[model samples]
Target: MTLRIATAGKGGVGKTTFTAMMTRALVEKGARPALVVDADPNANLNYYLGVKYDATVSDLRESLKRDQPPSGMSKPDFTALKISEILSENDGYDLLAMGRPEGPGCYCFVNEVLRAAMTRLASKYAVLLVDNEAGLEHLSRRTTDDVDNLFIVSDSSIVALRAAARIKLLSASLELKVKNISLVLNRIKSDAEREAAISSARDIVGKDTQIAAVIPEIAEIGGMLSSGSNVFLLKDFPREILEPLVSPHET
Candidate 1:
């Protein structure tokens, strides 16, 4: 079975960073070259993974919508070819980006083609990690139909926590086939802050979900990211927060 792990959090809460680190950790644990989906429009997962991508799903969407198919090729066929070409292979994972649509026209067709293509592409991998947008509009749209583990990451700030809560609530309301939902507090500086976030989470994120892990802020990793250095080269990563996630399910 393909284990699908999707992340949700407000922008700047280290969601993308966490996703990249988690991918690196998983690869270290022998889940190398897993399919990584950069669903966020901002599209910086490539930088963290230290690879360059030729195109994005959004680029395909615009191209498909704007230009006509060549000769006898159908839209789906042409899209499949383009998507196959855009898959960037790197050391520990492959990157697929979802770019923003260019035109003001409706994107229903674009979404259909992209979602189907993603679903088809996912079948080849053992694990799929998606770095989603802050609001998680993709969940509501069902781009990823079934999620084995949905991680809601947040910073220590109450505003970030509240955004995490909203994501939890919004995802529950949608008809999403989510198997498990958990919270992750990123960039924790002290025990007191961790305790406070855990305390607030019980009320804000509801009873069913739990604060699965608290990641301490690491200056070394921060410096690497700030300098646009490849995280995979860093010998130390937050395994405390990522190891549990690499396995199939947490007990």
Candidate 2:
């Protein structure tokens, strides 16, 4: 069975960073080559994973919009072919970026197609780590279904905390069948502050959604990212971050 995990929060809160780290941790646990889906239109997960790709699902979708496929092929067949071709490979994971940078008109049709393709592709892996856009728009749109665990990442700020609350509330309102929704407080200065961060996160998002993890501020990580370094290979990322995510029972 494939485990579906998603990360969300307002921009700049390190959702993408955590997504990449957690994926590496899973691979370390023997779940090699997990499927990493970059569902955000901003599309920087590829950079964090240290892979380069020229095509996105949106790029393929736009081409379909401009020109019809050969008469023998159906739309679904074409979409599937493009999805298979665009997966950027790495040693322990593969990436599928959802769409290119924003363009004119609605991408509803393409999103629907990509969603279906992602669902189909996910079963081939032991885990699926999805890095979503800031809000719950993708969840609301049902781009991902039966989300096993949803991790809402936030910085130590009121705005980011409130955004996490709204995501929990919106997921409830949308009736998403998510088994667990946990808060992740990132970029703390010290381990001693974890309790305070957890308390604050609980105050904002409520007690039901526990603060699953607290990631300390590692300057090494900042330097790595600034230099366009591949974070998946970084040695300084605290292994404790995986404690809460991989073994939620302990948290």
- In terms of lDDT, model 2 sits at 0.79
lDDT of 1 by residue, 60-85 (tens): 66566788779999877777777878
- Candidate no. 1 TM-score: 0.89
lDDT of 2 by residue, 1-251 (tens): 77788888998999998888887787776766688888888888877877887777777766767766678998777767667788888777788888754455465855776577557777788778889888877777776557788889998888999999998898888888888888889999876677777777878889876777788887777777578787666879677668457643442
Q: lDDT for every model? A: 0.79, 0.79
Q: What value of lDDT does candidate 1 attain over all alpha carbons?
A: 0.79
Residue 158, model 2, lDDT? 84
